[model samples]
Target: MAELQTHYPDVVPDLPDLYEPLVLFYERGGEFVRDNAGFLDLTGVLFRPGTLRGHLGAPSLSTLSDTVLDAVDAEGRISYYTTADGQGPLLRRRELRDEQRDELFSRDLQWEPTDRIPGSKEEAKDAGLVELDEIAAANLIAVILSNTSR
Candidate 1:
């Protein structure tokens, strides 16, 4: 975990709770960036069309974005995506393996409502958690703290 703090040093985002993961959803470029604890995990990033295959190396684990977007529950059960875009969309799930201790994959997630009022998809992504606006606010606070640490 020290490696994560040492590497980003000044860019670590604050999370809702110390135990909860902080996820970043990119609007224009359909992608998700996730930070768990002190380690950076990219198992859940998504891509649009077939362009995902071209961008698998740097950001996420796989480059194949040609997957149909589907939603599954945290228990690994097939469930409907409540989100507009997520509805009936076919999605591919990939597990990111860690070489060290047991680590959590970014793919392993369940959608909980964020306090952010939804307008556009981008707005929703930037809004942070569905039920926890405070978490989003904490991330903003983390950004400020990270800057000071630098």
Candidate 2:
């Protein structure tokens, strides 16, 4: 287990430069960040997309805007957050369109109303479970804190 730096108050324990891994994680949703404690964050620094591209070796790992580090949650993924484009509050435009088309085209089923569900239970459950299968976990590169000692 990687230990936090307690020797000096000012010194943050050794952390790998995981800028890339984090971005990959975000694309899926920050599942790893939730599971692991003391995941080093490069929050204090301001790294532009271009700079990150140079290091992370990807063009679409991030956007031009800075990251919302605090955004990392148990279900960390893009779908968890509200995006500018409303083409999908559910999925991509084509996928969303297909799903919507299915809903529009299919015969509406007579659903039973329950005390717990004042509205459409299936729709509500589907909406709520968006995070369940939406974002996948990314494989982060483990940092070797011991290497820093040498």
Candidate 3:
């Protein structure tokens, strides 16, 4: 972790207290996007609302699943992860920061919370948000692969 921060100072943020597992999640997500670019392209579901919902089953599930994928896609090397709805935690975090900015402006203050903001790992765990368990991730990947192969 210290090595990553030291070497990739610009890529990795200075969140000293961030949950360790959350960092793993982000790293693993990037690997998945890189490794499965072919499957993602063949499925054509990452950025399409109708196709995403169709592949994932329910609308809410699709939205949540897409949000995670969109986050990874936005920060990944692949250019195909673009989303039309601006979904994902990154967007949500931006929205929260904007709201905080507005509130601070109205109150004539210039302070920002340094701990556990909207998109932090603590908030995610407190909200019971699991970015898909191992079984689910494997199953979804398998489904995409199988469907696209046919």
Candidate 4:
């Protein structure tokens, strides 16, 4: 807390209570950020598309602007596809392989609500968890905090 306050005097005080501990835990590099229950809950709460959109003043696509899409494509780290109806671009993964050479192909992929638990698709749906990319969530929080501090 002292380190955060000393390093980010102007910004630290403005951060909500829910955000501070997680930020500190992450800064300490104790372990995987996902291992922190508070961080996971914060991610589930604030990183959802609806919640982010609200924080971003209700933009049509929140932080997912065309410029961001183009930049992501230019980087070539991932591939994104546009919907035929022009809804938005989506990250499409064809396959992923584990250390054992077992493959999870596109057809075999099942969208689970949360990675914290093992459950059936129906159970996942009932869990009501919002799947969010950790890096993306961190970026979103930074953006929001930056904007709010000003």
Best by TM-score: 4
Q: Say which prediction, candidate 1 or candidate 3, comes out ahead on lDDT.
A: 3
Q: How accurate locally, in lDDT, is each candidate?
A: 0.29, 0.28, 0.34, 0.34
- Expressed as tens digits, the lDDT of each residue in 65-122 for candidate 4 is 3333222222112212223342222222222233111111122222222223224334
lDDT of 4 at 68: 35
TM-score winner between candidates 1 and 3: 3
Off by over 4 Å in 3: 1-119, 122-130
Model 1 CA lDDT for position 137: 24
On the 0 to 100 scale, the lDDT of residue 106 in model 4 is 22
Model 4, residue 13: what's the lDDT? 72
Candidate 3's displacement at residue 123, Å, is: 6.3
Question: Which residue ranges in model 2 land beyond 4 Å of their true spot?
Answer: 1-19, 22-60, 64-67, 75-121, 125-150
lDDT string for model 2 (13-125, tens) is 56544565557657755332221343443322123333544855542222212222222222111222112232222221112422321111011211121222113435545
> Residue 61 of model 3: what lDDT?
23
lDDT per residue (tens digit) for residues 62-130 in model 3: 222433343323222111111223231111222232243111101112222232233554555465433
- Per-model TM-score versus the true fold: 0.15, 0.18, 0.18, 0.20
Best by lDDT: 3
Please tell me which model should have the higher lDDT, number 2 or number 4: 4
Question: Candidate 3 at 108: error in angstroms?
Answer: 49
Candidate 1 error regions (>4 Å): 1-56, 62-111, 122-150
